[model samples]
Target: MGLTQRALPDTPVGPDAFVLGRRRLRSGFRRSDTSRFCDDVWRLAPVLHQRQQASLILNFPAIPARFRPAVKVLFYALLNNKPPAGERQLGVVTIHGYFQAFKEFLDWLDPQHHDRFSSLTPVDLCQFQKHLLATVSSAKQRANHRRSVRLLWTWREHLADDHIPVDPDRLEDDWNEDNSRARRRENANPRIPEQVISPLVVWSLRFVDDFADDILAAQDEWLALQKKTRRDSHSGHGARRRLAALMRRYQADRRPLPGGTEGQHGINIRHLAREVDCDRQSLMAPASWGLIEQAREDVGVDDSTYLRTEIRGLLDGEPWLKRISYDEDLVVLVRILTAAAYTLIAYLSGMRDSEVKHIRRGCLTTDADRTGKITRRKIISMAFKGEGTPLGVEATWVVGRPVARAVEVLDRLQPKRQRWLFAVPPSSHSHKAPRTTEAKTTKATNNDLNLMVTWINDYCRQHGRTDHIPDVSRRPWRLSTAQFRRTLAWFIGRRPGGSIAGAIQYRHLSIQMFEGYAGTSKSGFRAEAQQEALLARGEGLSLMVDRHEHERLRGPSADEARVRLDKFGDRVRFLGKTPDDNQMKKLMERNDPRIYPGRFVTCTDNPNRRLCRLPGEKDMNPDPGQCKPLTCRNVALTDSNAQAWLQRLAELDARLQASDALAPRVRVRLEEDRAEIQAFLTRAGVLEPADAST
Candidate 1:
């Protein structure tokens, strides 16, 4: 085959720096078209000739630094006078940019070797293969090289078949074998097989839910294609009607037509690349940017600004930011704080719903005046925070008159033993004990949450506010509990002037992303306390004094430190190591413990320090251990304390069984609560009666 070549222009259209290096363009010069695939070789001879002339005039600097030599050789091959006997020397190196690099790599392996067609040996080919593998840092690039080498070898084989005396060992023959071996090794041995799902594939499956009937119909047709032709035994009316309905919906949705639609938005893949600062080919790929946007719009998130924000969020791999409009969703906002309080503080305080659940109780009062008046009264329980130390959290919120009034009402209504204001009546629908199933205790189930989701979604739909979903192009919101913590983190981390006085008031009100959770950080409060303690040591103290003071401060008066450490150790005893060294080490290792370095030894070994116990114990002994109430040095475990704790537990349990309980529709709530109580008892070191079934 004759190489296809065009005469190089006398002047380069690009800047003065643009210059053509010797390279060839050929027609019918596929890598597969070797000497064996003759009859067309003569056609490429002229193009090769032209390439030779162009190469001589081309400037060295204009060509890629790596491809300069190969460019010269390709041109030289084109200019060859005699028709090459063995393998046609038609230059076609410029067909693909990668090919240029591939040729350069080949030359780098063996400077003297010009073309595989001329002469080569297995040892020489192997040497080149070894060099390419050793020098290329990227596995993908090396694989590409091996593929290219195999193609060259195939071309050589074709030449030999054409009776052109080409050496069998000229081009690397075992390249494919080597690559296969490497691939096997990579996929085997020490590493376990990992499942990597393409996001687009997942998105496609999700899209299937939105358009499953259409997908199934298309799949059915495709499957039918494999069957033998048969005479039509049924009328086309059914198929036609189904197709018509599908067409109507498709048209209404403005779906993409086969071979693309006439009025399709002409978003060039390259143009999208330029606009979005991404790869053009990637944009053009199936289920890429354009399709994702279309899917987003179908779901009702139609605002372009919202779309851009969502796209940016997706690219950054951060959780989506929920949009909140005060005018449109004030009711949701009203419930947010209360809802979040249960999620965050409940876990932190280790308080049952029957106890701290009632924020509006007289017991939470700050003032001595027990009168049911909203004056000088505060919610002490509401102000509580948690720490990883024996010192425990102190109340930060002061009770005011309004809170006191609510508390008074709660105290008057609450059972003598129970302090929770929101306690339900014993006849509540959610009072039944739950049956143990999996490790998951069922205070609530997906069905219950799904009902809430359904209600919220219906409410949004009825209000014509489909944008409840934060996505720029979708509507049916799928809210979950996991989002709660993330939303809280986002708000607390970004919201400014939140903790201190004299700070910018309501600074976060204008920031859309900053309007999620609004809880104060437990760790932040602990760190602040540490700062105060360090500050109390005085600025007059030198750095040496500061260090010495900090050391002296932490070294718990020998006995106190040892006792506290031992307590912590016993709690984390499951951790299989001492709390001071191992617990501290694990906390540091996992970055789990949130206490600051200068903070009091809160990661102390004492199990009583925090509401939760150290990890590794669950693995040590899988069977549920004996029940025990938690012990804390700050709170004496004397008979009074024990009795008080027990009474509090019972009261809380009672409240949980009330008729007006939260999530009253669910029959498993109280049961779940009991299960938690059981777990708490075990953690607290209390043992239930052996005969007790619960």
Candidate 2:
């Protein structure tokens, strides 16, 4: 065994030297028969050139070493091959997942087969698939594994070198069965229900308004304290020297220093700790010898008692500033103010979480008209979604007065050096060293919002307030970053005329308002609005169908409604629980019996007879707002519609009676309006001929 050693090269291997020369190569090569079997695997390194892929390759050397030529061929094909015309390069996550699946397969195959992966038959792959199905319980997981395996086989087949044995057509045909069983649920983002939002908004607004002075005063005190601390560090050498002398005397005498002992000059540990430059624990530390010496040189009595008396006097003068001295209390107050500002901006502006985080100082600007009057308040900030686009892609949200005030409050929270509007103190355990200016990350912002929710609930509980944000189902309504946008969209889409303060404003109904929020992603606010609309329509249809089955649909459109309901019932049987959009479209095509429950009208959408002015000549879309259901031949009125007309008629009668001294022409116009309502009521069988005359 000792005599079987290989000879070494004569020359030293420098950087430019050919280390693979005959003598050195023979000496360095593994003598085993299997060593050269898959030596070409190293050639695939160029294919896995991406940092992530290369790292994975280097880290998981076992996969390449065990699978040999097959692994190498797969990597080469994936790296060097161009994707099919509409396909994109696989994302890093996808590639990583495939690598994991291949590793798992190799682990399973190592014990069963001694041959290289290139020598395995189709039966081996079938066995692997069977093993995966038996071992993997999740349908999605199985699908992922199957997809990775299929891609591997496909790559092996496409390799120009024919290094791996694979039948591409046979593999594809055998793996044709569907394993993807994941069902996507609709309206997945949980919106803060209206009940919770109503109170949350009211409480938040009240907190901002009623306690504005308290909040501002606390913030100012915090700023003054920060400045005072800096000034003390630079100019309190005399004070420090006096305190050091007192500390040294106490240490030398092994007793309290004399002056205000009892009712005299004895220093209170608590008061001394507060007045000193260091924390309480640090003041008491053994390493305080240096600080004590420095303080001893500037000879004077400890002035902590006087400082405490002055602070108490200040607090007595302003009752609101009493609790501002407590660090914990000050932190809570700051958090409350932060939460209030965040809520106002998020809900009112309808900005995404990322956009909100990117909001910097001075983001709010007022736009003036030609007359120099401040006409509109706008928030100008960078939209991260358009990062790679040309300039002028930033989002500018037109906000109201409340939002502007919130921005102002946020501006005063951070130091002038801190540019971020939502800057927060760094965590104690953060990897990066703490800095005075640090902006809240998206995740941190979300967490803070959640903490705010908890704080609000806790405050309400302690104060015995009846107003508090309620929960959905039984769980505490866990607030998400997406909820702010979705909840706002839900309200605007469902209640265009709903009162917030007093009246419905045009800003609430503007299309551009939502476009700014939804423009951040391909499927943003518009998709959310559409989904909400669809869900609303579905719910209404379900209720209508239930009413029709109970023979409750007594109206002009009752017969037509019954026919449509029967057709929907038949389709429901075949389409299962929830029919997709395409299925619903096909079902609604013939006769097109779409219901406008909000307007109390049913439209049998006949383009030739349609009377909606909002849609163009070539467009078949109907606008419920402009629907002239009373005059259109395709319109059908239900009981609700009849009742609404009667209510309007009564209102008109009251107005006519109230305006008895009006001009004859005004009376004539009122009479004509009254006559139209009576005619419609009579035609719908809600009023008799005699009743119309009356």
Candidate 3:
């Protein structure tokens, strides 16, 4: 394969000669813009938007004048060719960040060190590792710096003058690359706290389901009013009649006119000027002032100051907000509405920021049975993460009705001709100014999400409601788009039988995510969910072992439970410190397969005697739902399990004594059930023969 492969020549190719990292260059990308390309400003055909282009444009001139050739060659190879050792090709985004690590390496190296890589020695490499420690805050980041250095060795054949002399792979002592990988198995972003996500999602749903229609209606009213104002801006002659009509409409709606800074709900001459067909100067003059003040008084402006729109939003089964007006409030609501859609889609669907943004008009599809009832709802978006293609491959997310509803709301609220669901929202009520066609960038989306939280808190405070989005520590939880998907994975993984918000089942979510929803996974969710389950199991087992809860267990397999639990406890015991993720991972992966705990019993799993297994099932795990504790040889019970058995006998005793007489057959079955539990407990020594008289 190496002999047949073609190599890039030392002389640089034209900027237009098919950019390598992306599967294909963008159709609209001009081939003639050779200046930026020659400057090594690498561009990829963006999957969603051109947001990453700024990062891809490298400044080769910044490097020390001598070593530029080697660095350029290394980058070109990374960009255009399949990486050696069967490594996957780097994506455009990956290459963008990859260069940053190298930049740090070069900055520290080229200052006082050798001009070429071959001149670099072991001592110099050790010092570079030390430099990384002093400069990078994270151990994981320091390891990535060394990875870039290692790449210099990996591509040594191509870097004729500058190949790294020392092998980075051998420098395990200084860098500790293995430790970093194990420690950083999970994501770095903090999960959205329960208090934060609960109310945040509740309010977001409220905005989408309950408040969206009102906000959209108010937007239409405001836009129509603006257009009418523009047309009447020249009709100063009929200003009085127009003013009278406005006053009557305001009185009927019981809303005061847009207030001036002068007094509470008092009319502003400037507002009247825009409302009717006159200039501010004319409206401020004696004649217009006479009409405006009389209109204000006729509308009962002195009784209150709040000018609410006709459409009301709910709070505590009533309207949530005090008012919705047709001005900046409407614009702000649009922003909140977009944030709501984002929260729903991102949290529930597990789409990345890029995929979420790339969700355009008509992306939602559904299948219905013959009765016209919808069966499954799916969202069609592009996954850019693994795709080498310019425009990403089409990926589908089997989302719930909430996600479907949110998409509908987004389509309704989106500005005219805005293709993306999260495209930059209109800034003003008029929406006349043209904005960029890109979706809100990650930073912008993050800001909007936190703002959504802030908006909810303030709304709650004003309404005397206690169910606000709460603070995490002393302050509000800082939210970001990156946190949502990761948090949902953790949520789905741990609470398999429970519901997340109110409607969707966590177990169903796990299944959907494992099957159709691996946005990063091909199935990252399946793996993520399994990791969470293991973590939960580890936590439970740690508690049991630490407290010596296993010592009191009683059943057929009690001896087996004790021996297995002891081995696990001894192996995983840290030096009086909490085990971190790496140690926990090691323990979970290597823990004995025999001991599987449940609410009523622990299965010291002997698969041959397992009652829960189906006819041909050979899975290592025994099904807990189908557990037969009294008869299965694998069953072992903790001290708490006896209390449950005692409670069940008492309930059975009461049912037999019921005056509404049970049939003879029902009495016989109930008595037989009590007798069997009594026999099991008697053998396990958790019950006295005298106490088993129920």
* TM-score of each model, paired residue for residue: 0.21, 0.64, 0.83
lDDT for model 2? 0.55
Clashes of each: 42, 8, 10
* Model 2 Cα lDDT, one tens digit per residue, 467-517: 667777877777666688777766665554455533435345336455545
Off by over 4 Å in 2: 1-86, 89-187, 193-217, 227-325, 332-350, 365-377, 382-393, 398-405, 425-439, 471-473, 491-512, 515-523, 549-562, 576-592, 660-668
How displaced is residue 451 in candidate 3, in Å?
1.5
Off by over 4 Å in 1: 1-98, 113-118, 155-694
lDDT of 1: 0.33
- Provide the RMSD of all predictions against the true structure, rounded to 1 decimal: 28.1, 11.3, 5.3
Per-residue error (Å), model 1, residue 608: 44
Give a tens-digit lDDT track for model 1, residues 1-694: 1121221223112121111122233443453332211121222221332111121122333444333333333333333322345544333322233354446555565456344333545655566667767787766566656544443443432232221133323343544333443453221111100111111112222222222232223323322332322222331433233334533453576542222111124322232232333443444444454453453355422221111111112212432224322122222322321232333232222232322342433445343446754433333443222333222333333322222333343343334554444443121233244422111111332232233344434545665644222221254333333332233332232332223211212223212112111132243322322232233222212222224322232221223433433343344445564333223333333432122121112222234343233444532211112222233221212223334545655766676667465566453666665565445443433426551234
Report the candidate with higher TM-score, 1 versus 2.
Answer: 2
Clash pairs, model 3 backbone = 23-388, 313-319, 313-320, 314-318, 314-319, 314-320, 315-318, 315-319, 315-320, 521-524
Top-lDDT structure, candidate number: 3
Report the Cα lDDT for residue 19, model 3: 44
lDDT of 3 by residue, 1-694 (tens): 1211222345354443544533454554454542222344454433224431322455666666566656766777777766788466766666666778888788887778577778888888888888777777887678778877888888766676568777876877765555676656557677887767877887888889989887877776655555544344555557766777777777777666676554325555455565665556656556656766776776654322232455676656776555655444767777888899999999888888877887889999989999999988888887766565645678888888888999998888776587876776554533454433356678777878887888888877887879788887798888888888778877875664443466767666656656565543352556666676777677777788899999988889988888888887877685366677556766778774457776667788877888889757866578877899999988888877777877887898889787259888888899899899889888888887786653
